[model samples]
Target: METQALDFPKIHAVLRTNGTGEVTINGTSHPIQADDEAAVLREALRLITDTAAHLGRPVKVTTTDPDGQGLIVVSPEGHVSEAAPAKTAPRRQKAPAAAPLITSVPEAVPAPAEQPAATVAAPVQTTPTPAHEPDEAKQPVTFASSVDQSQSPPTAAPEQSTRRSLKETSFLVSAPVLEPAAHGWRGILTKLGFRMEPSAEELTEREDIRTVSQHWPGPRTVAVVNRKGGANKTPTVVMLSAILARYSGAATVAWDNNESQGTLGWRTEQGGHNNSVLDLIDSSQTLLSPSTNAAEIARFVHHQTSDKFDVLRSDENEEGDHEVTAEEVDIAHQVLTRYYRLIVMDSGNTARSANWRQMIHHTNQLVVPVTAIEDRAEAARLTLQTLESRGGHDAELARNAVVIVSESTDSKRSMSGDALKRAKAEAQRIADGFAPHVRAVVRIPYDPALVNGPIRYEALQPATQRAWLAAAAAVAKGF
Candidate 1:
């Protein structure tokens, strides 16, 4: 066996093995066993090929064997030649000098960057020869013609095509001159996007109304409230608490203000608690003694769902167990604000109740759920009236107070065309009556799912039920 050295400009050697039976690259040896020789040869050829490619230069490998068979080829420009001969004649040749010629030509001649004076003059002073002359003589004539054609000014075909397209588009868009009546109709049609008629329901719902409230820093303390019972206020509070817990992952406290009945805790599965809101109110005298630590007062609050929310249950036996003096309510509110990011109170419908007044005053939002029936409408009106009386009439509160119409049937049972019309008229009258006093009045259509007590956020109808969640989000935005 003989050894031969090959130069590869691009690839650098990473490893090599002993050259006895097998040679390795950078200590990675391969035995010349069975078909291993072919693999080694292939790897070596690949290395040279890659090296040539990287260096941008060609390489040639040859073995000293008598067969001249183990030969690898690479091009000077880093290209591999699989079949081409390794040695070939040179391709470059020197140009011969020629006499200068000049001739008349058009504008826009592209002069060479460093053309000699002789070359520049040759094109300008070319002699005009006959086109039908011998091949050798016609060559110069053809060259001169090509030079002249290249220098000639370009025709404006592109500009003409563009102008034609613009003219065609303008013609298609142009309206015919019309009579006064026809022109007016056409203008109206155009303004209405050519729709002859649009849905009345769509038109009425087109006006997008958004809720606005004062931005309160720290935890978003929302009160789930409605003056009237069966308005799904308790269910709304439960679902809102779950949604708030799911969204914020922060601890929330659901205060059961239904003193007459522990409905909130019962519905939420947090019943059988002795230290209810009444207990807190009874103990407020000692708890709110200016000397009592606010943090300690917060500890009396019981957790309903571990880290999620704390439940403040009301006494079921006592008639007015949740009732508290104004001072206790004020102190409790201050302590709650310090401990919680949110405080959702399930308020009763009685407008005369102290809890109702306190909740309306301290709440960031007053969610008033009403039924489509006349009685529920009256209750909603009263609830709104009570809130306005307590908080003072303001545009923001009026607009932010969500009047959700619960227990509505999708089959038009209660929302018949006449009933809907009446409801609309009543809603308008209510809105108009409280104009400038109520900020906004939104109607949440009744969802059947809410009838089965409190439902999760995901269970509610996405289109209609979202009004409540949107209202909650709007209320949260204040924080």
Candidate 2:
């Protein structure tokens, strides 16, 4: 038997934005740089293959990137394949049958020349081999043409009964069934008894759904930020919250973290009462009390019936002179976090405000939304730069931010032919500019539903909904 002890050291690689990352093997770290994440993975695989060649064994590698985690095995001969998870349960081997002991032996007798005496042969006795025995003894034995058909075969010994120990049997058993396809031609065929697999597009959609429908260890906060008005921050927050809540079935809230008079309430469905974040603060003492029921806190936040998410709007009283202070932000956040598992915040156009900075400190994921207009894009860039300059948790959030570039809504109505083509090109160009700086960049097409009126998940165009789902999945990956 070939030796199973020839194992190579495992490699761990992390791919960051702009194709720069680090790979660790056998406790030693190596720098890896390339043009993008795909290129970085290729470079890391090459390094792993080289290590395998040097050690004359196949190397296993684990990777973490924007695409998520993966495990692969790389061989010196340039062969690569996904590595299956290692088993943890102890293995059971079938015990060999014990040989019968002989009591007495008879002397051999010569056969007569006239007629061959019917030869009586005793059963062949076998000895058990020790662990230290040669490898040849361990080789499996085969009997075929050597056996005489006329002679009766020896009675085989019964296999020693082997039963799994109670501990070896797992009480936690998972379903061993496959999910049938439910979309495209595969669905039709499956219903007709063909059992066809899902198409690539259906598979991709399922993956995106699975990605968004995940819950992390604790409550996660995503900040949709841009320090410039009309950058589509509110729309981004609404769509992210809607997608997350609809798919994950978790308590999600879109909080207007603006300082004053935010438009989130105007663009979303309202509850029975005209309550806002300020109202929530006024009732925080009761909401945070041990006797407070989960549903009791819903009085201050409006619920979007179709989107399956709640909205915590900013104070919209034009006659009142008030701003959300940093301390007020903390109080509101504490109350909301107690009731919601996910918080998608819409920011005001002031990055330097105490409330805005306080929101940043609690953010788990940063999303920058910008229209195709040059000023909006510039403002988004400046916001990320400001965070990066802070040099701590803020900088880390900036480096791992997700930038979403949305096409200008007015362009679709006013532009056409060459003008419309140029508009789309501009949006793509803006999205590309942020690809190197942030963890991911997603481009959203202009949709009429997002231009004005109350925003609802069902009101958006199908393409617009898909784009938002992809964006939400990308944000979920950060958690």
Candidate 3:
């Protein structure tokens, strides 16, 4: 190509290694291999060029072979011509004159001559001045021009400007403009006093606020745990992460704390297995340091569908029983607390582990997924009892813990008449037993697609998904 001055700050260099050597860009891992180096460099260059062009700048490139040297030039302006085109400056113009004022007057009456002295003598009158008098002969005098004399024509007043300004000042001194919609039936009861019931739009807006409140991080860390397989914990974690991402727009991590092979990583479709929480803990132990930089740890994790969510994969090796330790979990909490607005621990079932209990202790909310089955209800109750026995009796834990019944097909769990009745009774018992401490007992109906793979939020059947989103909303409300 023709030579031209580069107009961008810098052009990225793609280092290609012959074998398994690591590639570093600006002292950071390149995150790609030699086989893909050309393509990566091309893509990076394309992005840089597009950005420079958008900013009216230029980016240039240089290449080299196996050895350590090459030259590349970039310009802050993307001009390629030998001589940059001269920019034609804009010219100023005079402002137009204001519109003229017009006033109307009634016709004047002629003066009546005096009939006095019975002789109606000719009225003495002064001679009028000639129209063509010379300047020197005429008296030098000035009169206000009609253009300046007439008061500006009355302007129509704006209707609400004054009222709006008053309202704005009152708001500044007294209250915010966008206050929360009133709550409960009292709002409906007091409609005559301007305490009207929230409109549909207002209710929708309140729901959004509630959703935001649920996911924001506070003083406590929360983990959603279920030890049983096929409990929908992974999907729950993913959806929760998506919601948190949508709300916070800050760093949020979904940790696949399950040491055993799990689906958290698979759901996000990220491939690397070399770096995970397990690796981090192991590296920390070997280094003998308290590592708490989230960006550093984040470099090893995978990004989920949303930019806000990151994933820490489970151990890939099937036979590996390596579990998260109490110390490691604490370290993770300390590190995560500094960087993330919300950290979602997808700790798969295996509540028997000491580490799992520690995870629960660190969390602000513990979501336990139960199916609407007799056995599942019994198991859920037993799990609650276990939590109570393990020192989860504090008001915070009691109030924050939730048991969600999953896979409800027809609002009932079992086919047998007696079993169905028992299931309903069990649900009520669970709700009643956990009352005051537990916020609500919710249900998630059976959706076959969830088991197979991730589904789009919009594609889910409205009835089932709406209930799920409502449950999510409830979860958010508790937080």
Candidate 4:
């Protein structure tokens, strides 16, 4: 076999050892005997060479799992020896990008004094699975196998909450009429007039959906927040609520909290009452009364006929100079919480406002949405940082937050598929950094229908709808 181009100046292997104090390789415990040790050493060397060969250089390997991790060095001749304990580097402050996917050799390993400068270089991260993620979501994209340095016993990987695929759906329902005699179960069922319900391929339950469904806690608040305007906050709230409502068959509402002029109300059904959240608060006495229930609450809110969720419009009256104060929000929160199974907030751009701060405090899960634009991303980063520094009610929000990178670019411009892929890849790259800080990252591709106006999931194209489902599933898992 050709030599792999792994030009690493240093390499260290962190291995799991049995009670007998011998390292296991490929399921054999304590490969201490000549043959077993040789096999273990050979496998380790093969892993390194294959990894280095892919990069066409000497491979670097780093092991910094602090949970009783054992380390060893592989000689060029394929001999395995214990790594110096004191010589090991300090705890890894941050894992490299490729740490999630490709091989990561630590700078902890000491290189021979004669090694050249070109050999000791930057770590090669896999367009790697993830920096903060465990198992890099457990299935790091088939780049290569990575040695798990965790000292804990092996566990099953958790399912991914978001779908990362860019491929469009190809499954289409055929005409209800059976073409000919049935062959398979689908055709036989179709011939029996069962095609209308469970068609040839319904493909209704998606991976993201199944994952999210596993963690369904009823009645929670998800705040769609970003300090930057036009970051698709309202759209994010609408789309996510629609997706959750559709799947969970639960009552969902999008509450717009803009202090001044806001547009979420403009896009949703105005309902029977011209009333907004302010009106709901004003009638809080009756709304929150023991006699009142969800049906009565709908009179004050807008209900979307096409979509199952409701909308609580912001104070849209220009004359009142209506700014929703925390007290008013509290009243509405009390009522809305009682009635709605999920309350998604379309928050304002002002992070400093009392309303915004209160929303963050009450938020069970934070969903920070940002467009692909640089400034918007910066604003999102700032928002997360501010939440972290706030320290009171919001410090943990940044840690448990879901960062949704939305593609607000107009699809009408007709960008190429490759360009779209590049954009998605960039979004994933940003999300990789966020994986360590937030619970998960969700990406919503640009949908022309959602770019502006009222959002109806039915009106969305199949691809757009799929994207929303994936985004919502990501958030549902966190809940």
Candidate closest to the true structure, highest lDDT: 2
Q: Write the per-residue lDDT of candidate 3 for residues 1-479, one digit (tens) a residue.
A: 11333422333343332221222222222233334333343333333344344333334433221222234332333222112111122211221243222222111221221110011112111123356866345421101000112233323435544234544343121211233236556465444443333556557656754675453435435577655665567777776666656664656778877746777877775734457776756655433345544446655677656335778777776667776677878776665665567777887667787677678767777776666555655565566666766663433564567767654434233256665566566656655655555666676655554555544454456656555665656666656
Alpha-carbon shift of residue 476 in model 2 (angstroms): 0.7
Tens-place lDDT digits, model 4, residues 1-479 = 11221334344443221211122222122222223222333344455444343333334343332222343333222322333342333434443446533233222334443322211122322222345666324431111123323323323335553454546433332223223224346557657753222332334434566655453555788998899988878888888877787777778888988876578887777788888888788899998789876688877888888788899988777596768888877888888988988899998899999898888778988899887777888899999999999786698878888888866565357667886777777777766766788887877776678766677888888877777777787788767
What ranges in model 2 sit over 4 Å off? 1-178, 411-417
lDDT tens per residue, model 1, 1-479: 00112342212211111211222222222233223222333344444444344333344443211111223344322233222231132321221234232222112212221211110001112233454655334231111121222232322334332224544343121222211111245447636544222233333222121222222457655665656666667766766666566556655777766536647766654433456666676676677567777556444565544325567766666455445555655666665666566788887667676655565567776666555556666776776665565555323454567554543534323345776566566655554543354444445555555555434456668655456655455445544
TM-score of each: 0.44, 0.65, 0.51, 0.57
The lDDT values for all models are: 0.47, 0.74, 0.51, 0.63
Runs in model 3 lying further than 4 Å from the true structure: 1-205, 213-220, 271-274, 283-294, 392-396, 409-437
Clashes of each: 27, 0, 20, 19
Model 1 off-target regions past 4 Å?
1-216, 271-274, 281-307, 318-322, 389-400, 407-437, 440-445, 461-465
lDDT of 2 by residue, 41-130 (tens): 556656665666555455666655433355555556545544533112332132134423222222112222221111111222122234
lDDT of 1 at 225: 60
Better of 3 and 4 by TM-score: 4
**How far in Å is the alpha carbon of 89 misplaced in model 1?**
49
lDDT of 4 at 49: 43
Reference-based TM-score, model 3: 0.51
By lDDT, rank the candidates, best first. 2, 4, 3, 1
Candidate 3: Cα lDDT at 374:
58
Ranking by TM-score: 2, 4, 3, 1
